[model samples]
Target: MSKPLNIIFAGTPDFAAQHLQALINSHHNIVAVYCPPDKPAGRGKKLTACATKQLALANNLVVEQPVNFKATEDQETLANYNADVMVVVAYGLLLPEVILNAPKLGCINVHGSLLPKWRGAAPIQRSLEAGDGQTGVTIMQMDKGLDTGDMILKATCDITPSDTSASLYEKLAALGPEALIDTLSLMATGEHTAEKQDDSLANYAAKLDKAEAELDWSLSANVLDRKVRAYIPWPVAQFTFIDEKQNPQRIRIWQATPLQLAHGKAPGTILTADKKGIVVATGDGALSLTSLQIPGKKPLSVADILNARGHWFTPNTPITGQINE
Candidate 1:
């Protein structure tokens, strides 16, 4: 008969915390939890515990926070746990080969995307930005290369037209923990198979940057729409324009949609501004900015913003949406 495994769980963010919670509820024994060291956050700059660390403390699990595995003491501390397997989910620190091989079953990961499709730091956002029809969770056997691991299991979900990075994140969050628990169960019963990834099909998902959020008007409305959706809840899609005051003003786009119509105007020109939407000309089509946020104000609908600041988005004006950087 198969027995539950001793797991050493490593993770940091809220997504990781969700998986940890699942493991805590499972039959497996969690020997320890590993997360990065606390760091300053928020306007106050006070030290803050990551989601994983807070959950570990709440569950009274052993928590390890080594800066890195460079020190022999840290590696030895991990080795002493004698864990059967280590589960890693969005743990920021890179584990050295020695630490990776510490557990009896080595380490496995709960990656946000299907293996080889989107591999690296920002898989969730990159998948959405690429306009992928679907994306899913991959339970991968940890290897030395970056997300280049054998896949033990994959559970897919569609990326709807209305889905943003944040919404896709919620979907994967719901799918990932269940997949991780299932992988563990299969491993316990010796029923799991690991499949090698086709490197030729791999697409590296580079980390999100604030600079990438700049709305380049030259791009097609379809491309810009994807970017706007992908950048939400982080560096919200933004564009600059010379306001009526002649000063450069930056506005963040919260919600927008691509219109198939063309206005024959230069890219970034404001075609129309009304209660329906703020229609701006793009390289191929137009984009209707439905929700937006300006400096010192919360996000508001175009109708509400127009009621008070209609002059800010006057028609026939050109916005500085060119990607200079």
Candidate 2:
């Protein structure tokens, strides 16, 4: 009978939890699981546990949530796990060398990009925003450099024109566990080889933030369309019309499609509103917003919103949305 490989898992968020679930389902001997400490979130600032921590506890595996594991002595505890292998997903904290070298097979990571591109903190969001043709997961042997690890396995997925961060995230999250399982199976059978990432071709997927989520009217309609999709579920794109004629209402756009207009109206212009949706003019074309959420209101289809609040917006007027200082 084949012996179960003793493993240490590190991760946070729903993405990481998926992999942990995979390991448990596979009958792998996970010695310990590491994740970020509980954080204060939401209006109450209540302390909430990370997704990984919740899973680790439920699975009866040992769990660790250190704020900063950069210290040499602090990392020694992980080295003591005597793990045969370490599998890391979107574990928020960076692992030091001591912990990396703890396992016999070193460590492996499930990164969310094809690699040599979008290789850092926010790969999924950046890929969609850049309008990339394809993106997927790269299971790599963890190295000191950030996501510059050598690839042991890779699987690609198409990025549809309508793909949003939320949709792509779930797709990639499902892939992580499946890809990790594939990598582990090959590694167990001595059929895996690591391919080094090209240093010069890499692009950093810088962390997502509210600052970048503000829709810029000056940019071409195609660009803003991607921005609206990429920023979904986090720092949603917001625009406020300055015209008193319009309600200075804030709306969170959830999805959009680009269209070329024969008439080039100024960007941010309220081109029209109909049963289909609200069409707004842009630098090069226009965007039809299908779904959106008004401030302090539930998200609704554009048609429902226009029918209820038709007076706030008029056809062929500048939207007047501004990023408030």
Candidate 3:
């Protein structure tokens, strides 16, 4: 048994929290934890603590949530920890030269996707959207540049056909801790050499938002289905329809499936809506709406939505709005 190394963990979100839990379970000398400050969330509009911050507070680890790490005051705060190493995961805020140089072993970043690919925000979603067959976590020695850090460990995970963002995220979240432990174990033995990422193969996973989440009916059913999966749990795919008073009722597409429909019908055209579901013709095929959320009502299954307000989306009805560019 070797002596535990002091670690300063920095991250945000549930994915980061998952890794922190594993570190605590392993009983490392966690000097302090760094995470983002609480932000307004939910219907109540109350300030909600970040996932990592909440976990740290519960575990009694010192928590730091600074506006910017580059500030002299913030750097002083981080240096006070006197940590042996720093671990970062989805920290959102960038690490500056002084802070990165503070820890004896430097900072290790547990990125969602393999380094040199999906190297920015929304990695998980972008991987699925791009139809990548596989993705994994990469533990790297952090640097000033984006995710350009040298790789300490690489672990792969398969992307299943039906794997949604939510499901795959859960799988990857578990993998991060195991990989982190292995990297740290090797580091302890002084046998680990961080490998440089291939810059030529790099790709950026641009941030996603409600604007990109809007459905483009002109796209094929397959493409739309991917969007639905990629944007789940945030900024879901949506389409517009005319309501009773002719007001635009934007429906958030929660779940859908692709269908082989002979197309020639205008994209965004509703082909039918009986009991099966709303079969909407696309540019190349059709999509079956399994679940959807009307603008002001709760999310409803295709059957339920049709039962309550089927008149708005009748068969052969044309969907309003231009296919989102």
C-alpha TM-scores of all predictions:
0.97, 0.93, 0.94
The C-alpha stretches of model 3 lying farther than 4 A from their native spots are 42-45, 321-325
TM-score of 2: 0.93
Q: Give the number of the best model, judged by TM-score.
A: 1
lDDT (Cα, tens digit) per residue for candidate 1, span 72-191: 999999999999999999999998999889999899999999889889999999999998999999999999999999999999999998999999999999999999999999999889
lDDT of 1: 0.92
Once fitted onto the true fold, the runs of candidate 1 whose alpha carbons sit more than 4 angstroms away are 320-325
Candidate 2 lDDT by residue in tens digits, 173-205: 888899998888877766789998888999999
Worst 10 residues of 1 by lDDT: 316-325
Q: Which model is ahead, 1 or 3, in terms of lDDT? A: 1
Top-lDDT structure, candidate number: 1
- List clashing residue pairs in candidate 3: none
- TM-score winner between candidates 1 and 2: 1
- lDDT-sorted candidate list, best first: 1, 3, 2
Runs with alpha carbons beyond 4 Å of true place in candidate 2? 1-3, 70-73, 243-248, 321-325
Q: Over the stretch 194-281, how does candidate 3's per-residue lDDT look in tens digits?
A: 8999999999999987799778888898888888888887888887776657678788988888898796788888887866778888
What's the lDDT for candidate 2?
A: 0.84
